[model samples]
Target: LNFQLLRVMEEWQQQLGEQHYVAMANDLLMNLDLPGQVSSLTDIGPELLVQLFEAICCDCRVGMIRPAVTQADLRHNLACVIDSLANDVLHVSLSHIRPADLMSGNYEAIRNLLEIFHGLMEFLVGRSAGGDGGDVTAETQLEENENLNGRLTDQLDRIAGQAAEINELAKRLAELRQADRPLPQTPLPATAAAAAVDAEAAPNGDTSDEGIVQ
Candidate 1:
């Protein structure tokens, strides 16, 4: 998938020039499409979504995006991805009757969802730290700018907070799964007495250890 993205990027840079190519990339990142395909992260499934995000981040970092893709676009796309994932997490979390069941339910899919958000956040923070738009001026007046920025900030903050809430719930559920799971009687990597100990420990005959075991 990344190889294909690279090839497309090369072709785009050659034909459309760096500026337009950057704009195109921004559209893909924002709208989650690639040329003729509807290749959004949600559309790609869990396995490929992370790879696609990695490719997008790489493009943002060193793909020579200039004169078209602005820092604002980068930030906007990151925010969009974050917001989208947050909504997904909230939906799944809210819809489920038992949050702990998430481990046996849609756990893998939910984890993948969070992973994408984390990846985007890492890229966004890294790009922001590079002073990508440091020279860009905020020409708005203080009062009006503060009002507008405050509203935008509030929206992003709400999304981020929702994502964080989902993340915390996921973590708690995962830990619940782990804690409820029976511990191995024999530890892995046997010591000098390896010949005597069985690597596969017997499952606990005690059922109480399993809490809401699915």
Candidate 2:
């Protein structure tokens, strides 16, 4: 499913080129679901949400390139998408599943969010390194860099925090599942339970079904 989206993005990049693709992506981001429900996504299933996240990441990366989008616009969209996935999706959906039934795909959503943000951060770093700060005064460039850095740091923190939360939740779930599990069955009492208990407890206890000593 992820492969298909990547292929589509690659084909689009080939057909539209980076600049136009980025523009289209920015527009798409503006319209895509922002306050989407993680619960709702689960109802339909994770595959759709996974694809949506991947598509957003791919487009946002293209849009962040030179001559496509302003840093402000890119950052705003990134924030919205990340917030939606984190608050509306990962955190919310984690509450719904049983620990014994933890799905790998749920964690995949977190990975997808991290992947997108990391890619964007890398693009930002590359852009900064390559003098995308040009045409601005030194003070302005410094402030812009600071703002971008802050946004990236806040997002990385959010993603990292979410990852930790998921880990803890998984552990807790395992504990709960283990605790809730039924104990191994014991042999049933023969005749009266009190007599069975006495027979089992005697010094020469031999309550075998084949030879129950009186």
Candidate 3:
């Protein structure tokens, strides 16, 4: 079953999770880029959010150089480490804001965010090309990731507000029904369940229906 592969996947997913949550937190932080202290994780801006999401999805390759880990495992682990460091960037951004004047893509904020990802990936390419680790700089060039369409918190807020309002309306409906109803004298079949629940029910009730609304 390639348990190691599975573990590697699990680790990668966790790295994604950490990066996912943390980067969103950064976007929510000192939104305007503070000077030296970490901005709130929630203050990270739109552009940073997109870049972080791209870093999460992008595949990173790291070479096997007599390490205890295999190429795939090492790649997965290194990808995870890169993600972890990206979160570290967000963590640092909470308190430290790189100045636009000094921000030339070589600073620690940039390093903390991107260096390891490109460096290790390139290191893999070099080893493949010539069988040795190549010189990789502590600086990396970050291309802005274009896929993260909207801020995570904004999405969450919209979903949550819709859910709350919908659920509240459902509650009001249920109260109205109760006031008008006589308890069914005969226990109805499971088929008689309230509309929403029945439509969404599995034996375990794990349905993707409007329950999120109700």
Q: Candidate 2 has which clashing residue pairs, if any? A: none
User: Best-fitting candidate, measured by lDDT?
Assistant: 2
Candidate 3 wrongly placed segments (more than 4 Å): 1-150, 181-214
lDDT of 1 by residue, 122-143 (tens): 4444446756554546652344
lDDT of the structure predicted as candidate 2: 0.44
Structural similarity to truth (TM-score) of each candidate: 0.26, 0.31, 0.20
Q: Please identify which of the two predictions, 1 or 3, would achieve the higher TM-score against the true structure.
A: 1
**Residues 37-117, model 2: lDDT tens digits:** 332212323233333555544443322222225545444444445555445433332232222121233433433343443
For model 3, residues 1-214, the per-residue Cα lDDT tens digits are 2334444554553354345445434432333232333333334332443244334434433232233344344334434444443353222222222223113332224323333223333333443575345554433212111111123223334434644654555565556466765444536534345654656564575555543334
Q: C-alpha displacement of 124 in model 2, angstroms?
A: 10
Model 3 alpha-carbon miss at residue 56, Å: 9.0
- Candidate 1 versus the native: TM-score? 0.26
> Global lDDT of each model?
0.39, 0.44, 0.38
Ranking by lDDT: 2, 1, 3
The reply for model 1, stretches above 4 Å from the true place, is: 1-39, 42-144, 181-214
Error of 3 at 115 (Å): 30
Query: Which has the higher lDDT value, candidate number 1 or candidate number 2?
Result: 2
- Tell me the lDDT of candidate 3: 0.38
Comparison by lDDT, 2 against 3, better one:
2
